[model samples]
Target: MTHILAKYLVDARYEDLPANVRKEGVRTLMNWVGVAVGGSREDPVKRSIAALRPFSGPPQASLLGRTERFDIMNAAFINGVSSHIFDYDDTHLKTIIHPAGPVASAILAFSEYHPVSGKDFLNALVLGVETECRIGNAVYPNHYDVGWHITGTCGVFGSAAAIGKLLGLSEQRMVWALGLAASQPVGLRESFGSMNKSFNPGRAATNGIFAALLAAQDYTSSDGMIEAKRGWANTISTKQDYREITEGLGQRYESLLNTYKPFACGIVIHPAIDAAIQLRNQYHLTPDMIARVDLRVHPLVIELTGKKTPQIGLEGKFSIYHSVAVALIDGAAGEKQYSDQAVRDPRTVALREKVTATIDPAIQPQQVDMTITLKDGRKLHKFIEHAIGSQEVPMTDQQLETKFEGLTDGILSQAATRVLMDRCWQVESLPSAAAIAQAAVPQG
Candidate 1:
């Protein structure tokens, strides 16, 4: 299985990608850059830089949204952390893996160290996302249910495959890279709602680069590390569907399945938040007008975001109660809605207390049944079959631009943000892929 995947990655070319898949790759890059720049000044990023800057080697690549540069590996790690800090990166709905954080983060950083064409970058990005998401599909609920953060664990393969492609590794070397990546899986579900949660993707990006670099040097490992009896699949999961990894190598593109988050929280809570925001906008409702906000959601929503009272912004992101409350009170759930100040606001707190959720097995994770009780003895019911950001209902390009603008509002000048957005859209045409990173940093 590992050998077959490596060969596929080695032989895949930009010209083979379908038009829609390539377009989605561009969109993924755009969303990732927006979030990374927006989250550059976040506390976790700041602390990470402060802690690692001293140990970092000579600067080889730019860190998105900041002036400082670091070694390619460190740049990948930091940018990966920034992209995912707000829980706002793109997601593969089936695996719940934020594909770009681990894959794009590594390859973009590597682009700085070694100049690659935009086409090559995009191709690598697609392959990387495909590699991880397929592996993720293979071990999903079992790997995830066992407390492994699937993104961090599966993401390393993405990083390795992407970097390996750029490095022009032989099929054997690519297999070795995968083997090395298998030895290092970072992240646990226990780290959710904390700074450490962001650390997973960061480390995955770094580890993949490390694996690929070593493999390029002929670093050796068991070739069947991914599918052996005691390998990653069997060791980490009870069920291993190797077919998911090799069945449709070039024919199926998982990158096209990528979905961006409209709200800055876990994907499972999106339906409820979408329902709340729609009802709030439709009725022009205020906290005083809302008697109670009731949600009948998928079991995963409460299992993942059941926090009744979230003390901080990150914690609030994992709370369906808080997400719905803010969506109803503010009519939107942007970064501001999930901020420390927002979570602690008296009005938000009071409204969140009135929000309650019940799990329904029949309700799909992307569907929600909501009822809003009013102070005037009126009840408003909304049943969301699919959330706005789901694959069934994707965010429009204009909506994505609006989301980009909102995230970068204070962090970057309108001019700079626009330039970055343009570069991201024009990535495939750019002479050097590093131009995106250069555009991401604020000018003096």
Candidate 2:
């Protein structure tokens, strides 16, 4: 049977890919690198890397943003963790799958052990993203509504497929890889407010890479793992819409639909940030001028971004109140806004107390919207038909580069930053994957 996944992974043709698809792939790579760099400074990622010191494996791979090296799996784990440390990684808004976390993390780590050209990097990344987004779209509202982390659940399959392509797996063997990946799909939304959140993708990166390696050796599994009644698609997911995956196949690329992020918080908070930023500029209001801020949103937003009095950095990302306050006060929402000190600031806490969300049952049926009322007798309201990065207004190349530089600034010297950016832009061109692995390591 030609399943949706098989149609894309096995039968899809790459002849008609649009030009911008390739450019977007590069943009996502840039964004992911920036996220990984920014995330390296996170306390959880630091602790995780520091904890790995006892393993003492050969330094065969590079962990982006850190000089520490480990086996490919460990390296992928650390890099993947760092990418989402701040929840700043790129996203495919439609699926809510953070594509770069699993795809870029696994591919970069695998490249460290296996050399492939920059063109190949682009191709492999493009394919991985297509696989991920398509699967995400297929089972989306149902899968997510039923409670599953798509990035961690579908991510391993996509990451494994990408790596298998680089390893030149036969179509049959690729199917085996997909089956192996399906058996390992894992991630949970319950961990969103804590470090368990980032750990999902990192673990998927490790599992995905390992799966591909095993499949390349002619490892075997049931070919129908994705569609079997008791298989991955139905067991762990709510429903299987196979056409979404098989419809385009290779005739169209899924990567083009990927969205880049402009902020470093949960995707649900973006609409509120946009609304708040607008109010900040139009009202010319400083933090002192604001009396109260009220917002309306979908229940998911409240569930995900509803941390009322977040006490820590990670918690701040999930706090709609804190995120809105940061956008209005700081005029920007970046890693610094989520710093430990930022959360404890009295002013931010006070602002959080004033902000409250209305669970409008009407809008809950279709989308998320937010309205803010200010003390100066001005009311600013916006119906966020779509969030900023929902494949609606993607971050431009210049914007992405600016973000990358900012994240890697002190961590990587100007010259090194330039080198890494160039390497990522032309990743598939490298004669040795070792070049990227070595380049990603932080300098002492």
Candidate 3:
């Protein structure tokens, strides 16, 4: 399995990618930059930079949305951390892995150290996402059920494959890179709702770059590190499907299936939030008008986001109670809705207590059954088949642009944001991929 995957990654070329897949690659890049730049000033990102600055080597890459530059490895780590701070990065729904944080963060940072064409960058981006998601597919659910954060664990493979591609590694060297990546898996499900959650992807990016660099120097490792009896799959998961990794290498692109979040929370809670927003807008409902809110959703919704009361913004992102409350009160669930102030707002808290969720085995993760009973004895019901951001109902390009603008509003001037967005869309035509990073930084 390892040999086949390495050979495929080595042979894959930009000219072979389908147009839609290439387009999604740009979309992935665009969304990732928006979130990274928007989150650059968050406490976690600031703290990370401050802690790493003294130890960092020569500045070789720009940290998106901030003026400070760091060495490629440090830049990749911080950018990966920034992109996921809001939990708004692109998610491959199948594995719930935020693909770009690990792949894009590494390659974009490396692009500065070694100039790469826009086409090559996008190709690396697509292939990286494909690599991780497929590996994730091989050991999902069971791997995830065991408390391993699949993104951080599987994401290293993505980072290795992407940076290794950019480094022009031969098949043998690429196999060694994969073997090295197999030895390092960061992140735990317990880290969710805390600063550590963001740390996972950041560390994955750094680890991947480390693995690829060592391989470039002809570092050695067990060739079957991923498929041996005690390898990553067998050791980390109860089930392994090697076919998912080796089958349909170039033909099936997981990158195309990536989805951006309309709401900045766990993907499982999206349906409830979408229902709340729609019902709120439809009836002009206010806190006083709502009597009791009831929800019947997949068991995972409660298992993942059952926080009855969230004290901080990050915790709020993991609470369905808070998500529904804010969506009803604000008619939207952007970054502000998850802030500490918003989470603790009397109005939000008061309404959040009124929201109750019941697990229903029949309800799919993306579906929601909701009931809103008004103070006046009026009852409203909404059943969402698929949330707005689900692949079934994707956010439009205009909506993506709007989301980008919202995230970058005060961080980057309107002019700079527009230029950055244009650069993302036209990334394929650009001579150098570094222009996107340059546009992401704030201008005086």
Query: CA RMSD for every model?
Result: 0.8, 2.2, 0.6
TM-score (all chains, Cα) for each model: 0.99, 0.94, 0.99
Report the number of backbone clashes for model 2.
Answer: 8
What is candidate 3's TM-score against the reference? Answer: 0.99
Per-residue lDDT of model 3, residues 74-193, tens digit only: 999999999999999999999999999999999999998899999999999998999999999999999999999999999999999999999999999999999999999999999999
Worst 10 residues of 3 by lDDT: 435-444
Off by over 4 Å in 3: none
List the pairs of residues colliding in candidate 1.
none
Model 1, position 134, has a per-residue lDDT of 97
Clashing pairs for predicted structure model 2, backbone only: 12-250, 13-250, 117-428, 117-429, 118-427, 118-428, 118-429, 119-428
Q: TM-score of the candidate numbered 2?
A: 0.94
Per-residue lDDT of candidate 2, residues 360-398 (tens digit)? 767642255655666667766767666666665667677
The residue pairs in collision within model 3 are: none
Backbone clashes in each candidate structure, one number apiece?
A: 0, 8, 0
State which candidate has the highest lDDT.
3
Per-candidate local distance difference test? 0.93, 0.79, 0.95
